[model samples]
Target: MVTTKLEIHGRVGVIFHAILEHRHYSADQPPESLFQFIDYSNKCLETVKRSVEEYCAAKERQGFFIEQDNLSMFYETLCVGYDWNENLEDHSPTAFAESSQPPLPLPLIQQQQPQPEESEGGKPPKINLSQQRERAAKLKYKDLADYFDYPIQEAARLLNLCPTVLKKICRQEGVPRWPHRKVKSLKKQMDKVKDFMSSNVCTVEESASLQESLNKLQRDLDITVAGGKIAE
Candidate 1:
């Protein structure tokens, strides 16, 4: 009988390790019960979440904070495998093989790419105002919050919005609120700043300055928007 195993393996911190094991029946087993796989996957995720939360809380109580980048790396490496027909297009055998390979490491390189313009005369292209507003309205606050590691309240405040209104906007945009708490660390903070800058709303120098400012603000503000002070 072919055996399918799902394993979660990673180092939580300098001295901590995390491993979760799960097994599912092979294709020869009753495939009609595949819905069990979904339940199994959910259980696996919940287990990982509980483990990581406990680990983080314990470390924090010990005055050793787990770096956000480390936490992100750990989650990224947690393998979630599903037992399915190898011949299925969505489950192509080659895809499984590729997923097992270690991701390539590369240095960060930024090259300026030219932006498309209306014409050589350099007149800025005209955009439909109504369409632009419609698109902007579609921007999901929850997804943005997740991307920036902020709570819905914090995200809404930063965007000069009402939490309920922003949440509705997110739902309209088909974006789900991130279920996990914001991971905290210098690396995560810098990453958030970089994302904001890359939105082309700010310059590199501005981004760097904002990153530094935000770090300082987080320390003072406790990374939450409270008492009318937006965390951003």
Candidate 2:
């Protein structure tokens, strides 16, 4: 199921608000009581408690638990009273994803060589394909660089920059890498969707379905898949 904001905000935030309200409700001593630090702490807790209860009650009324994206504007509404309520809205998707996929012990451990191109010591570890004017390379800014086709000092002079500064700028800007194929593919998908929407050809239902398909594709595929497609 797609993670929804309602499950995050209404369910989790409500429980959090409830527990905090309980603590504030019973806080007569130090540490538990925020009255000393915050003005109208009691009222704040009350508002939080009321907001949570109301949200839960409303959700209970509608059978909204089945869908992944639980429809609820409760978090936005609660944002008026509590400053941190906005966090639930922002972090819900990320929090849900983290909960589903536990992190690896070491991310670097999984990064094995795709296929070693250079076992020889003299050559670089990766392929140096800069000379090739492939379609993939066309998407990058190299054409502009190639237009001048001058040596470092000359190119710097043309751009009204010092050679050292130009080198630094180039280093900072960096060249497009292998995984850039994925960015190109994603951009294509985005353009397709935009074109369809702007053309006024797709019916409302078709538009919604197309949006869903695009979203699913966006979520499921990454650089590896796109790069593989590019290789094929």
* Residue 213 displacement in candidate 1 (angstroms): 31
Cα RMSD (angstroms) for every candidate in the order listed: 23.8, 24.9
Residue lDDT tens for model 2, 160-186: 332333333333335222233455576
Model 1: per-residue Cα lDDT over 1-232, one tens digit each? 1112122322321111222211222222321111111122224545656755664565456544233322334224222232122212332322222223332211111112224454457774443434643455566443354434556545544543434344454444443433224334544665676678678789778878887877775654343212123444
TM-score to true structure, per model: 0.19, 0.21
Clashing pairs in 2: none
The window of 10 residues in a row where model 1 has the poorest summed lDDT is 31-40
Off by over 4 Å in 1: 1-138, 141-147, 173-232
Assess the local accuracy of residue 83 in candidate 2 as a C-alpha lDDT between 0 and 100: 26
